[model samples]
Target: MRRALHAAPEILANFVAPYGVYEMLAAHWGDTDALIASAVPPLLWSFYELAKTRRVDAISVVVVSAILLTVGATFMGGSARLIQMRDAMVTGVVGVMFLATLGMKKPMIFYLARATVARGTADGAAEYELVWERPGVPQVFRVLTLVWGLGLVVQTSCMCWLAWIWPIGRFLLLSPFISFGIFGLLMFWSLGYIARRPAARAILAR
Candidate 1:
């Protein structure tokens, strides 16, 4: 419960704050400028967290990178639809990054899962590192990485197609719901898969 409370600010900064900023500014600034400006809260929050913690992790890098990429896309200055489509590009890029990690000794899921399990404590992080050495744990992370990578890619494709066909206002209205739905499904599947794996269950028991 304490951890969840601690996480609330970040959740609001990343998700709610941005949308609220965009809505507030969009009428005056237009979609492109409003879109770029909406990135400010999360960007600032990310830097604040980084400064406070004096540490950088895979998730931090990804969040900051995605914000920069989306802001950059807005600078391209096309239709409002184009600005909306930038989100799909960001997700697709992260998905590609996830796939790219397959070439490394540890997949991206290892770091992501570690961050979740560790919850910012040095001792907890060290313990989760040891969990990585357990039998079959590495393979589980790899498979999860693959699944998540493919899922994001598919989600991006669908979002892009929808953006292309739908009006800008309609797309913007529905986009968050679609994204949340896909992400929620992926998370559900991942949890169930982890639950069925003995090695993953061992990690959870810690």
Candidate 2:
């Protein structure tokens, strides 16, 4: 995710900016065609990336939301601030989804982790099903889901605040770093928590 986010600016500069392929086409063919052509590939690629995984339900939500945002941004004109909001919107929706899953059979993280292990390891999905039913497992995932859901909401609010106050160029450049920083922090915290969590440790030890 970090690598992909970092590469985006370069991709835009190289392929979509002035004298770049998209811009060159836009110069002759016009903005609408250029925009569609430029956006479709990335959108399709995003879906393709998600399709490679087995977690269809969660993956579908992410990919669909992304495509909707990309399309919305495309037609919403080229304002950098609005683009930033659109990105935040995706985060917000994802956050809400995470929270909503607290009422479901499993939290979002459980499905995500299970799918990852299932796809990456032999017979891991069945083991995951068994592990998921163990004592204390559901509560842990529910708490985690709540934390991540609220965390994402907070992250989105911060991004929106920055977009409101900061220059577009600066926001565009700095916002990703802020997000990466949050993600890094959360990742470290999750790792530490998991290391100390007997249930998580037990699952892994299997």
| TM-score of each prediction | 0.79, 0.72
Q: Which TM-score value belongs to model 2? A: 0.72
Show how many residue pairs clash in every candidate, following the order shown: 0, 0
lDDT of each: 0.80, 0.68
Error of 2 at 116 (Å): 0.7
Off by over 4 Å in 2: 1-48, 51-57, 202-206
Can you write out model 2's per-residue Cα lDDT over 59-132, one digit (the tens) per residue? 55666776787677666765545655765677777888899989998888887767666665678777788877
Per-residue accuracy of model 1 over 98-126 as CA lDDT, tens digit each: 99999999898888767666665657777
